[model samples]
Target: MSRERLNVQAPVHELIAARWSPRAFDARPVETEKLASCLEAARWAPSCYNDQPWRFLVADRHQEGEAWQRLFDCLSPGNQTWARRAPVLILACAATRFGHNGQPNRWAQYDTGQAMMSLVLQAIALGLAAHQMGGFDAGRVRQAFAIPDEYDLMSVAALGYPGDPAVLDEETRQRELASHQRKPLEEIAFAGRRGLGFMVPDSLGWKAKVGQSACPGTIRISIRTWLKPWSGLGSRAGGCSTWAPAPAPRRCPWPGGAFRWWPPMSLRPRWIGPGGWRSGKGWR
Candidate 1:
């Protein structure tokens, strides 16, 4: 897993850093209890109005040989070229409508994605490898499993222990060895408008578990021309407006320190100001 870990720009949990999809799976079959734990983690994922719309159909190579082959048959040719080595296969599905209201729940697929995330993280926590893929025949799966039409297929994940990359083809071996990359934080999140990059200072980071230099904040988007600039609090950096924090000798999270940035519970942030600011500790 160390090879999978990349030097992330910001601090993230070891579980997240270590988690990566590997096409190479060991010959050893995944443990049943571990699979159950992964499902339990997914079961607790948050959903729209707690609808819990996700369902998982699991197939084990050692136990459910016939069922596993049915799933394997649905995979795209390229995916099957490698996925055949995995010991466990799972299909994630989401309800098309809310069970109670019978209305279209557009966020069902999103919530199912959250559940998959939880399951994958739990898999990594338990020293297993989990890889999700979208290359599969949805119609075939519905036909094979006799799935109800009310449910929409989300994705499929392969689960097992890490294996030797030597077995893979040249191109796949290169890809498996290559470092995985994610888009910069600025690219995905915007300050106010679409394509506007939201920036975060390097000093600001989250806790590994809890209470370890974590500085979480909520940011507000507004045009700078309409608001008064808080003196010595923050500057118009990257075209984002800055605000002042009241009360003397308080911690100014962004008082023109290493980088000018801030986020808080409300628009009127009471955490950043002109005085008593520490380098990393925020308020002195």
Candidate 2:
């Protein structure tokens, strides 16, 4: 476990574990092609009615053209302190209404967020680190960018190659070094009811139970049969796989001291990892 990777509870695609926002960015200029590929990834993100409501105003520090300074100026002082070092800045915005119908699209922001997630993940795959900031002045952004009243401000992102943590201020450095936190699966995922815990096998202490049980051969056979179909999932390029092999099968203690199988993987999962991240290195 390198310091850069997140300490995830369960197995995850190496890319997701690798993604993180860093305040200390190397001042090197990002290539235009890399930026274009990132937006291209965002362009394909799924949206309600395929509205593709997300839009971006990009500022390359090397270029410094087209509202680049205006975008930087809108950032709050606290953010500006660190974002100044970033080689690229992006203004994320949302079209508030449907392009086809002119009626209000209630999911505009939500859809735009999906696009941003795609964009950010793409950035990570390219060996770039992106940190989105809510500290910018939205009103200032609207005026400075000459954005229409129909558009809504989403966020500002600072992007560049990762740099030394030592470059950050003491407090910021500490925050960057701290392990990323996520709520336990039970707290977020529910079964039949909203509050009911959906126990993931990793959190269920099932593996330890399986190890203690006398029937090791049965457990191996059952798990192997369950995961056989997905043994090589996400390993090939340009394939149609839904998930990247998560929440594998586990043995669980059933009622009256009997053991049972609960492979929530049957429900499947999200994410087709970007092809580049599947093979790219340099995230360290």
Candidate 3:
């Protein structure tokens, strides 16, 4: 099967770039060893204080009788529309309290997210597609599985081989073919201070272009560049502002080095008018 590849500005590992979620799953059952390996990957994920608070409840469609149907029933109707064909379903949960001291583990949910990513990446390595879904009846899951009150049921995942996108409805089929995109670096990253735009530096040997649309007072700046985060920005630093122009540079309290700026093509700033925010061009 042809896998959809990511359009990354900077180089990344092949496994990270190839990973994606698919709505259509073939009915073939995942091998027991492969499933175990996926779970094993999740088991090894690092967690806060090594709490290992993540848990999983799995159901395979090949299982006898209502075992699979019970899981299927927990899915929302929209998810059920495509997820019914998936061969395996899993519910991810996290323990809310620490085992030793019984204190609240604030990082439980975040740790569970890391574990789930490990599982998904393992599945991708095994040539299986794992799609995590938030659209499920959590109450139904708790009731069906006899989950303890201390556990938070976070999400459901569908796992199996990739299926033909033609099996999906027309609207979903189009979405399956759509390219993945991310917001430009300038929109999220900053240089000296908060609300200041960091232009890509030419010394990095990369090109950058800014697209803009204008209104009466506000302008939206869309930066297209191959820039990555250098060091940590200040905690209070804001993202691209919709209301104002780039603020003057100040002595950044952050000990990290300054951002190298490079000049490239034209960048148009979008304007925000009284009617409403006007549509503007952005990185694709």
**Cα RMSD, each candidate:** 12.9, 13.2, 14.6
Error of 2 at 238 (Å): 21
lDDT of 1 by residue, 1-284 (tens): 11222223333444564567889888998889999999999999999999999999999989999999999999999999999999999999999799889999999999999999999989977878788989999999999999999899989899998777778898887777665566766788899998998754432211111111111121112211112235665532222222211111123233232212233111212222233322222210
Candidate achieving the largest lDDT? 1
TM-score of each: 0.70, 0.70, 0.68
Candidate with better lDDT, 1 vs 2: 1
Cα lDDT tens digits, model 2, 1-284, are 11211223344443554466778888688999999988998999999989988999999878875567778989999999889898899988999999999999999999999998898889877878799999999998998879999999999999888777668898887676554566767788899999998863311111112222121111110111111223455222221111111111232222112222222222222121211212211111
Q: Write the per-residue lDDT of candidate 3 for residues 181-223, one digit (tens) a residue.
A: 5676576778988678666432222322222323211122322
The RMSD (Cα, Å) of candidate 1 is: 12.9
Clashes of each: 2, 0, 15
- Per-model C-alpha lDDT, please? 0.67, 0.63, 0.65
Model 1 misplacement above 4 A: 1-7, 202-284
Worst lDDT 10-window in candidate 3 = 237-246
Clashing pairs in 1: 218-264, 252-273
